[model samples]
Target chain A: MSAPFYIGYNAKMPPATAAFLRRWVVALFVAGAGVAVALAGLQHRYGDGQFEFGIVKSFDGIISESPYPNLIVRRPIGTDAKDVRSRVLLVAPGKHGAQELVRGLEGRAVTLQGSLITRDNQSMIEVRPGTIAVQAAAVAGDDGVPLGNFTLRGEIVDSKCYFGVMKPGNLKPHKACAIRCISGGCPPVLVVRDADGMAVYFVLAGSDGGAVSSDVLDKIAEPLEITGEVERQDNVLVLKAEPGTYRRLE
Target chain B: MTLAYQAISWNRQKRVYDTVMAGGVLTFLAVFVVTGLVLHSEITAEALLIRALGTGAFLLLNVVLSIGPLCRVDPRFLPMLYNRRHMGVATFLLGAAHGGFALVQFHALGDVNPLVSVLTGNTDVQRLSEFPFEWFGLFALVLLFLMAATSHDFWLANLTAPVWKALHMGVYLAYAALVLHVVLGVLQAETSPWLVGVLGLGMAWILGLHVFTGWREWCGDREHAGATADGFVEVCAVADIPENRARVVTLGGERVAVFRYDGKVSALSSVCRHQNGPLGEGCVVDGFVTCPWHGYQYLPETGASPPPFTESVPTFAVKIVMGQVWVHPRPNAPGTRVEPAKIG
Candidate 1:
């Protein structure tokens, strides 16, 4: 008998053609499943970043506006007198910094509600809108301890996203979003990894210790060598460098 | 082909094809997400969904593209081509979903409009390593949308076969953009050998299939420079074709489908008026040359669809000399009828 011909408008496919298609369709499904497993298995686990999402908690701390908004809270379990404060970076919800929220409250104690975002040792707060209230009058906070100037190589990422807003959010794939975040007032951070692949986050600041989010916009998500003065304010590190002096490393 | 266009004819075969396709897509997603959660528990739901949909769309498009060459290389694969527009439309929906999720996840909630951000987000065009790969994905998504929107026969008839075929050829361009999208985007960060190897294999498979089919077609067409007599070319013997079937011969750089049916022979343009499908590969069903790809029908003698259907292809004059079929090298205008030559 001649091979069965297939007419699509016909209600039934020829038996031979139907049988043939059944085999091929089975093979296609098997192949598709295999591809899905391979693709999913091959992905790199970028980091264990956590975004608390909607779990808002109240935090009382000294809110600083300069060099990007941050909340310096007292360590609940302080071991060393020198590290009694934990600097929790503050960002407004949705790709923005808390600068506007903390504009006039610099060095003042305040309580704010927000979700916590944490990756390794770095912590940030996605501040809830209209949640800040003055708790105490202006009080002096720690003048950052100077760590000697050093030349460091790292990739700059938006602090808001790199902390936990997104996972696998610190490389070429996340470059555009990082740029958008930084441009939209999310603080830019320089991420330097040690020889052991452990990342060290530094809040990027202009050489004179001011916000560098706008200055470092063009260099986000690229490898660069920056010669800067590093300082420790509470547990957070800040890298002070002139954006223009940063060299793009090939 | 129907005389009038409906949203969809919804035949049993089409329903089966779509069901199987949906099942395959759902299975892929279930496996990908479940396996991802097992492997990387820390992955965000949004991130997993985006990657799964994007990769799924990419793989589905690869399958959609391979179907054509697969059919050409082996006729048993014809059933896959029957409702391929269903796959095309599914691919577009998958792609649109992926793009939409990516836009919301990465670009929305930002200061600028999400659409504007997609275009202007990463101005790293100067550097190859940091090129704005999002633009490539956007380009592919737009093309897939165009193809899916016009996949129905109504558009094919209104646009004309050549114009419609040209528009659908954008699938290749979309595929190319997606290649760049994967290469410059995820691959840059993923950097896994398995990922790179699988991507290379998919590309090689597509390229190899097309090349092999093209080579076979070239070999078949090369036999055209044979003996000629009195403005006719000796194509093949009448015995070479089976009853209700055609023998395609390339004459004057055009493929002609010479059909032998009911003890008479008629020749028509081998190119189907719908999507340029090879009419010669089709069989005479109910006295009409039914396209194997989509079942678009044309009269064997006149090369025109029956009344209420306006599609037509060029016709050629044929005469049976001895037991051999001689066909004129030139073609008559589309829909022009020439009397069929008797067998004896």
Candidate 2:
């Protein structure tokens, strides 16, 4: 008896199991396809640009006009440069005296025949058909002649001043200040001296204490040919110069 | 006497069937372990599923092949062979899952037409050098699907045994294709030394078991020689027996169990038929012989019932002269022929 043999041997299984397997396979395929479709839709949406926006507001007052007599009107600072909107006023000789001209214009602008000078000792005078439209500073005066042809020097001291007072006492003492001095009634200026001990003047303009307009400030270090005469009243030094006295440095 | 009779009546068929089923289940579990550990990857999720399916299919086929040989060696393993088509269907279903996932992942989402993509998507197939290797997996998958589709008893009855057997022989082609599939697709593509070693060891184990068992059968021919007439039937001397032993003999191509115990000799059908395990290979313990395969037993003299086991083998007459043991091929009433072998 080697080993028992089974003839006609065969194997069988329940039908339900096969049906269940087929169902499971079909469900997996459906779920996988769904995910692929969802991902493709997301990719398409992000590729196109179609989103949203939001806006905001601000304010300020208009200030000075240009000084040149024959200039055409131009645009306000914030507007695009090509647009022109504002105007300038003109003044004739004898129509207004310096004090009356400076007075009637409280918030209004006026034309005056005078030079522009810094309180720290530098000066310049206007020549020929000279006129400028500006709102007068609080301490502005007729006798406060824009100084020129005067020599003065001192250690560059700090002061709060803007363009109004050129007299010594007008500047406050010992206050730390930027070159743009507001309280002293004169814009701050740099003080330099020549070898002959003559005061060489350089006017600070704007907030940065560089010299004034190039035509007037460029001859700063050398002797300047000026037509202004100095006037002293109550120990305050001021220079009164004829418009023609303004000349380039020698 | 009653106790001896009670001990010899166990059923053998059910026992053999149970063993084969258990073996098939174990093989299925073993394949699951291999696939789960080896086929993990993110991009190739579909590929992994297919590989797992292939592994499961191969395991089922291996189990099916083992069942027949195992049943012949131990009829206690036959019950497992009875319900094995379930395993085959399971393998087919798993293979389908693999194919389905591969179709959707690589083909449905691909740029080409879905059918074309499935047919040509595998780079291994497109490359000329890898053609046959890649085609082997496709062929195996198709073969498994066909077998699984026709795995019902309905098909078995309709097809006839020879035709059914012939059709099922496609499993061999499937096996060969799977071997090449693994070699080319997994081994060549993965290039992992660990995987290579594992695959090599598994193939070696299966081949080794098959070869060793086959060799053992070829070398062991222990059948008895000379037939002697006793009444109308011829008896043969199976082998020399000691005081309490037995030998298996064949008469007219029918197997019979010959036993010598308590100073007498007796014979019975080698198979219990209820499960078909060798009755002679059983031991003469407590005056009854217990089958070495599944423990079915029979009394050496009466060949009667054991409690809880009602099966019996056909009893034959036996005798011994000199040192020779002999068996009568014709069966007789259980207790009539009991010529015990001489103790030498």
Candidate 3:
């Protein structure tokens, strides 16, 4: 409300006292700054460890079923056959040594030789040289169907051949049955030998594909000689049966 | 003008400032403790309590520094200005706790020497970008310690006003360093943006208020000097004096306390040296003029305190001639320059 008051009142003090207090304040400031710097430094220094590479091999083994072109070989450490242990030797494409070794082999086979390395406690062989061998089979007719209790013998012409019957009523049969019938034109029927050297009814299916009745299904495991034509298609082996093509072996 | 009146006013203002400061400090401490305890996961209940106490103390100091100037600017806000030094002391104690806890947490165990680890643990010395932020904190704490030590009236009396005032001014420096310490050290190291923002804002607010007040004061001084230099110097027409009443006159940046008592006009410094209480706003209850702010009584004739207070103010030469009051711009020693203003 009143005019702003400014008093020019200056107090006199002993210079010594002033100096002491100033020094004290300065000292405190220095100490505080020191502590802050120290703490920051400690945190930056001691804080936390940082890891890279994949699993060379797993403890679990691999599983494979088929061979050669249709070979479903499972490697011990991996799923695919290519991942199986093999050598990595360098050789010319037309080199006879590697070719001769593969030609002499019977079925799907691979041999490799190379140095091995261990990663994460798993062994991995880096092959220097390798060879793969495969064997070929024969062929048969398209619509030959073997009768019941026939000794059917045939080389596999199509390795992927299906051997099941058609459905009874519909012209279109179930996929599993139709694939077997159309691919080979007949199912690979089983045969069994009796006490006499004569072909007897083992298991049979009608022309129209239907379910295998329990009466015949019971004798499927019996061993018998089969005679038919072996067929190969799409790197697969199949057999086509014909009437009287199967004969009981004495 | 009596000593009793001055003492009463001084006691009243002191009480108000003290009480407000103390309450503010306690409240801040309570909040700080509760928040700190809730926030800290690793600290035990006891440690949390201690840490809270420490935090409260530092907060109290901040409040103390903030409220004093605020109260001076507006006395209506006096209630908020109480016990500011108490709050300051509390803040110092809180800071001590924070420092102590940090010391124990980082340096208590293992092969590393505590002192060396505190200084070099984080390899700050090796890093060029990392500065001596810890030094700032240390300096701030030391400043606080000095302030707390000299807070009492005993140190005040022993150190004298000028020295004590100068020392106390370190609060501003300490606060500045503390702000930098937090910014460069805590905010830089800690990635939490929200926390950094809050701390920065608080510091900015305090600085902004101080700057505003300082600017206002400068503007007021300029305006007053630009206006009339001789107009207000005339205290009164010589015939106007009725008995013991005093008149306030402003002349060239000086306030003159003019009094007409016992058939003569006398002049003394209108501003009280203690807290700048207006002397002219007071009255001559006896032979002395009492300051309205804290009622510091000065002998109207001598411009000197009666006894133990030992306070004094400069007296001005005056003339009474032809029913006009006139005063000389130059001030003279009290008791010797008792001549009345000439009447015109």
Top candidate (DockQ): 1
For every prediction, compared with the true complex, DockQ reads 0.77, 0.01, 0.01
Summing lDDT over every window of 10 consecutive residues in candidate 2 chain A, give the lowest-scoring window: A44-53
Model 1, A16-101: lDDT tens per residue?
88888888889888998998898988896567888899899999888888688888888731233453778888899887778788
lDDT of each residue in A40-61, candidate 3, tens digit only = 2222211111000121211221
| Two-way lDDT contest, 1 vs 3, winner | 1
lDDT, each prediction:
0.89, 0.43, 0.44
RMSD of each: 1.7, 35.1, 30.3
Considering TM-score, which of the candidate structures 2 and 3 is the better prediction for this target?
3
Write the residue-wise lDDT of candidate 2 on B156-225 in tens digits.
Answer: 5467646766677797788778777666644543445655654565567567666766776455434445
Error of 1 at A213 (Å): 0.6
List chain B TM-scores, each candidate.
Answer: 0.97, 0.54, 0.69
Q: What DockQ class does candidate 2 belong to?
A: incorrect
Error of 3 at B193 (Å): 3.6
Interface RMSD of 1: 1.0
